[model samples]
Target: MDKKPDHTGYWRTNLKYLLILLSIWFLVSYGFGILLKDTLDNISLGGFKLGFWFAQQGSIYVFVILIFVYVRLMNKLDQKYGYREK
Candidate 1:
């Protein structure tokens, strides 16, 4: 006999992860890259201004990283729910 998984808990956690990750991306890309560009410009990264970096390249890097992070998180989530691929 198979026990039912707690779908409610699973989806709740998934949504939480999505919101948090998206918020972080938004903050980095829009907040730092645009709204706070002037302030961030005071700092530098690899010869480029921090703000410009985030706007031009940093956001893309962070997004790719976030993709991997989401994958790892979902993998663990699936395990927690006894989800397995056939």
Candidate 2:
């Protein structure tokens, strides 16, 4: 007989993924882009100051990437928890 999946563990893992991903996003957008702008401004990326890039476009790019990452993570999680669509 197939054993029942642990819903608590599944939920906990899902939440952990969310917290980690969001924290990364926040660090990049808020910490690097705003709080450390001056320090980042000293560096360059594609001809633009790193801080300026982050402030204007980096966060959006990171956000889109994070969305894809989340989708991928959730897919694996779903499969692990026997929740994936056949």
Candidate 3:
């Protein structure tokens, strides 16, 4: 017989990972792009200002990669922890 899962533990684990990822998202978008824009303006990426690149392009790419990475990582974690959906 399959054992009942500790739902609270599952939720807690998910919440912990979600919060951490969201915090990093906020930091890169708001912190590096907006809050530190002025400080980063002096820096350049080829011909573009570092902050502008981060705000418009870099963040998008990072976000896409982050999604894939999260999916791959969580799938592995789920398997390792026996929480994967059949």
Candidate 4:
């Protein structure tokens, strides 16, 4: 007898959130941090240049936020899909 695969709803939901979070990361780190550095450099935040801060500290902070966001989103998704690892 052949076995059928089980469809886990949580997997798709997690993947969707993961892709979105990563896209935002890429845009902030690569696009704004490097590609638009010149334009950003024209702006200043306090004592630091916008682009420089984004490239160094800003992106890092955003990355941390993204991680947290992903975790939260995943946890919610898991509960919604009845996949929470209680």
Clashes of each: 0, 0, 0, 0
At residue 23, candidate 3 shows an lDDT of: 80
- State every prediction's TM-score relative to the real structure: 0.95, 0.91, 0.84, 0.85
Error of 2 at 80 (Å): 0.8
- Which candidate should be chosen as best, given lDDT against the real structure? 1
Q: For this target, which candidate reaches the highest TM-score against the unseen true structure?
A: 1
lDDT (tens digit, per residue) of candidate 4 on 16-84: 888999899999999889999889999999888999988988888999999999888877775665564
Query: What lDDT score is found at residue 10 in candidate 2?
Result: 94
lDDT of 3 by residue, 1-86 (tens): 98876777766777777787778888888887899988888999989999988888877777787788778767866765678666
Q: By TM-score, how accurate is candidate 4? A: 0.85
User: What lDDT tens digits, residue by residue, belong to model 2 across residues 1-86?
Assistant: 98798899999999999999999999989988999999999999999999999999999899999999999999999888888576
TM-score of 1: 0.95
Per-candidate alpha-carbon RMSD to the true structure: 0.8, 1.3, 1.6, 4.1
Error of 4 at 9 (Å): 3.0
Superior by TM-score: candidate 1 or candidate 4: 1
**Model 3: worst 10 consecutive residues (lDDT sum):** 77-86
Off by over 4 Å in 3: none
Worst 10 residues of 1 by lDDT: 27-36
Clashing pairs in 1: none
